[model samples]
Target: MSLDMSLEIEGEIPDWEALDNAIRSVGVINYEIDRDYVFQGAFKKSDGYFWLSKRSEAQRKTVIAEGNHGCSFCVYNAIVFRINNFYYDDFVEDMNSFLKKLTSLSSMQFVLSFQYEDVYAVRNKRGFEFFWDQPR
Candidate 1:
């Protein structure tokens, strides 16, 4: 079991430096990003990893074509994190900090799962907005 967090980016594209800083801030390392800025790597804080990727326009269309009618809310770019079920407290603390950092970098739709309960939110210059008192 793991906690999943997805950030759908909006407006300007995030630069590698910003992404690197965010990823490192969460205790992730030895990652690599392609020209498209898609990246994946393990977390130094625990037994988990993350992947950030963007779908091409054609790919998004294909998902729609395949019958995911709600795909409209899905964006071309997203950063997804998979935190392993170990040291839940540490993960929550780290993610709280990471989410706060992200707010200053970009505007995004944030989706997070806590104990299998998912909550949708928006992250902007103001901050991350959602409520989930995850059990430790």
Candidate 2:
């Protein structure tokens, strides 16, 4: 089974080296660098999996209005990961670990959005997806 995963992080500009280190720690099959984004190669266990990481700066005023909840100073981060046949438990565990590491480094709440595709399903509709908004 192959799964595609994308991870986005917003808030607090990350040091490229630090970010790279954190991702490399995942022990994925392959990875590529493109500007501020990183793309990972497919995993045999996750043949159809695709992962993406991206970052964006937030508006300063939105930060002030939201107070600490606003990562205005921190870049707007978002991650989207798509999984094909992997089990939910395994995926969640991996994501939890990644989120923990990100939070520790930024010292600010991080938001997460997860989406999954059903390769076996007959419907063409999008797969399962979930999201959580974190505090600043």
Compute each candidate's TM-score over C-alphas: 0.64, 0.48
lDDT score, candidate 2, position 75 = 36
Checking candidate 1 for backbone clashes, the offending pairs are none
Superposition error at 70 for model 2 (Å) = 8.0
Per-residue C-alpha lDDT of model 1 across residues 111-131, encoded as one tens digit per residue: 443322344444534556644
Q: What do the candidate models score in CA lDDT, each in turn?
A: 0.56, 0.40
Which sections of candidate 2 miss by over 4 Å?
A: 1-8, 11-13, 34-36, 42-50, 53-77, 115-136
Report clashes for each candidate as comma-separated counts. 0, 28
Residue 83 local lDDT, model 2: 58
**Candidate 1 off by > 4 Å:** 1-3, 56-74, 106-117, 134-136
What are the per-residue Cα lDDT tens digits for candidate 2 across 1-136?
A: 4343433333445444554554455444666656745655533333334455443333322222222221223434434556544455555555544454544454333333223222111100222223322312
Looking at candidate 2, the ten consecutive residues that score lowest on lDDT are 116-125
Deviation in Å, model 2, residue 3 alpha carbon: 9.0
